[model samples]
Target: MLTLLTGLAFGLSLIVAIGAQNTFVIQQGVRGEHVGAVVAVCIASDVLLIGVGVAGAGALVAAAPGLLTVLRLAGAAFLLGYGALALRRAWRPGALRADPSGAAVPLASVVATAAALTWLNPHVYLDTVVLLGSVAAAHGADRWWFGAGAALGSVVWFTVLGRGARLLRPVFARPGAWRVLDGLVALVMVVLAVQLVVRPVGGA
Candidate 1:
């Protein structure tokens, strides 16, 4: 039980931070376009990564510096591209409708983007697989329980983030709010991309 709580706390600490995945999830929630799909993907991905980490994949991943480099570059490129699109949306602010019934983003596109945002970010691997795995190792036989705790945390957090966003529908009804959101999203993506390029994820 204690191990589970510790894992939950650790997982939430890592996930609560504002990042590309959270940003994208929030946007989908606000837009009310495939929110369930986005949240599910995020949660499933987290579970898979945490499982892999607990299964000792972290050591293997860390052993391969080349793999990290490739992921870092690819993630950066994707972030930059997404950031540019967000910036364009901010500048134009055309599809800023708070109404879910507004022009819908195709379900497939939303799912793909969500997957890309979650998978491409090297930080996700570092947090879920590497860090979480290392921490779980300390618990020995209880590691699976810890992973379960972490998975639960992911499910709870994403569910709240994705579903709770609808409450802000009123605020988002205004075009200005959407403009601000898009601008912030763009800023976050670009900043993350730059950081990935500069630091190269696990690179010194």
Candidate 2:
């Protein structure tokens, strides 16, 4: 029971950080487009990563520096592209409407984007598979329970983020608010991308 609670708290602490995945979820939630799908994908992905980590995938990934390099570069490229799009949107603030009535972003696109953001981001790998797995290892026999707790944390966090974003709809209803939000999102993506390139994952 103690192991479970520890895992839950640890997982929440790691994921609560502002990251690409959370940003996308918030954007989708605010737009009121397929919030449930985005949340589900994030939760499922976290669960899978946590399981893989607990199963010892972290050691294998650590041994393979080349794989990390490839993922790092690819993730950087993807982030830069996404950031460019956000920057463009911010530049043309008129294009952003808080209203869900605007033509919905296709369900398939949203899902794909969510998956890419979650999977391709090296930070997610480092946090869930590497960091969480290492911490879970300390619990020995109770590791699976710890993993379950972490999975539960993911489910709770994403669900709240996706649902709670609607509460900010009134603020987003104004084009200026959207401009600020997208501008921040773009800045975050670009900064993360630069960090990935400048400091490779697992580097000193």
The local distance difference test score of each candidate is 0.90, 0.89
Q: Over the full model, what C-alpha lDDT does candidate 2 score relative to the true structure?
A: 0.89
**Which regions of candidate 2 deviate over 4 angstroms?**
101-103
Any runs in candidate 1 off by more than 4 Å, and if so which? none
Error of 2 at 125 (Å): 1.6
In order, what is each prediction's RMSD in angstroms?
1.3, 1.2
Worst 10 residues of 2 by lDDT: 95-104
| Global Cα lDDT for candidate 1 | 0.90
Q: In model 2, how large is the Cα lDDT of residue 113?
A: 94
In the range 100-139, model 1's lDDT, one tens digit per residue, is: 5453778899999999998888888998999999999889
